[model samples]
Target: MELNRTTCYIASLRSSSVSRGYRRIIKGFTAYADVCFREFGNHVKFWTTINEANVFTIGGYNDGTSPPGRCSNCSSGNSSTETYIVGHNLLLAHASVSRLYQQKYKDKQGGSVGFSLYAFEFIPQTSSSKDDEIAIQRAKDFFYSWILGPLTFGDYPDEMKRAVGSRLPIFSKEESEQVKGSSDFIGIMHYFPALVENIKLKPSLSRNTDFYSDMGVSLTYLGNFSGFGYDVFPWAMESVLEYIKQTYGNPPVYILENGTPMKPDLELQQKDTRRIEYLQAYIGAVLKAVRNGSDTRGYFV
Candidate 1:
């Protein structure tokens, strides 16, 4: 992928049990990055593993609609384990590639390496207080901290131990150190938000409603959602920027994605005005954060 003066490209190369597959994938990716960078100079500067490692489970395994058709709860004939293994392998592979790129090009042109990943925002359901809070935290842990923990802090979240018990794999201190803080950029793609709630501690199934919605909340929590008022609030985006800044040490962030969807068929209403207002409000919030010293570079709608 050339043009726009890019020197390299990075997709998702997760780290998990599928080391062999991950290795092969990264081999191809690295070859492409090298070809593009050597041939283009300052055009492209990095490469990625795959894109959005979490989808391997969150959107694929737990949701029956996607390819591979892995069931939720992950008990779809062991498909859950398969998805987790693949996701883990991809992350490790990605880290490996970043390490290799850093080593091979250290004396060449001082170029950098990194990957782009989608990040999800989770909020606890209004009810079920303590349990809901834990649920939201768990969702965040599985959704964001899964990658961030291993990449930034060098370990999996503690909750994983409780969820999968001894089934969760362990990483050696050496391996942890190897991947810790390996990437030059942590690209974040975000849209909408998720409301989480605790359930009866059963393995998830293919068609089960999201824990949040199943707990009696509406399904708008799922994708491109913007209703139930607050359309003019920019605080949501602000909170996200602040969270990333604090958790990841303000590493250079790019708002890889941000946008709202308004159905074209709907008759115009006051909320329509609110939607435009929301955009201005949120953008202002982002600008304020940047002015106050956030590292956000750009946004994509």
Candidate 2:
């Protein structure tokens, strides 16, 4: 189906008045999810409420790289604040829908609901400095814990709370109760690992920071080449799984997207040797994590 300009504009959810619009967006999303559950609950046993929720907020609100494309310098948007606000609303919407299904349809449908997050295995650039090591943990908190913390522990990580301060939205007692432990499983989309370097933010910039700025670290992507390329690093997948297992109580996980991208060459596509090797190695990494009791349930390419 094609979306007209008006529909696309409204669906963008990009408004001059963000706070009020955020509430309406959440309400609309939850109502839509309720309809889908009532219509498809019997046929679909596993429902992923939102795919890459973290990336959607970050890319759309902070970086201006996705739909509705708003950023600090864009025609509209507060990169630092809007990203957090959008993320907060997305979580509330997901939890509300999950609760609706659990209360009304779960017993009869016997279905499970979860949400996906974009994950990266972060490694310190230099092992010599304690600062880099600390930065690594902080990056993880900003990237993974921003969402997982609420799902697993009922709130955002303390580091994030302290970093974002008032810009970050607060959850009430009842909202917290509903958000905590809302998902039956957590879906992860991991492509590569990043070498994290410690970076000190200027005091002025610190006063007005975006998500990456608040992270207080620089990420260098490494693989077959610099920048973006066909880089296959299976060990990164193993590290990510292990981190989730050791830190997040090893919840049920599905490798929702773990594949190597290739150019659209008919001959190369027909052969597809690199793709096969990538899958084999990554699947092996998943097996290692599962054998080590990581509670990983499935892998999808």
Give the per-residue lDDT digits (tens) of candidate 1, residues 1-301: 5332131333223323242234465456557555655665354444444556666444554453454444545445243354455555556666776776677664675656655666655677666588777666676666677677788887877776455444455667887887688767666666656666666534464234442222222223554334544233456577777777887788777665566666664554634775667667767888988987889876655
lDDT of 1: 0.59
Candidate 2 C-alpha lDDT tens digits along 1-301: 2211000012244444233235776677778778877776667777787778788778888888887688887887888788888888888888988898899999998878888898999888998889999999999999899999999989999999998899899999999999999989888999889999999977875645788888889899776653334587888899999999998878999888887656677886679776778789999999998998898998887
What stretches of model 2 exceed 4 Å from their correct place? Answer: 1-21, 204-208, 224-229
lDDT of each prediction vs. the true structure? 0.59, 0.81
Give the per-residue Cα lDDT of candidate 1 at 42: 52
TM-score per candidate: 0.73, 0.90
Question: In terms of TM-score, which candidate is strongest?
Answer: 2
Candidate 1, after superposition: displacement of residue 34 in Å?
3.9
Evaluate model 1: give its TM-score.
Answer: 0.73
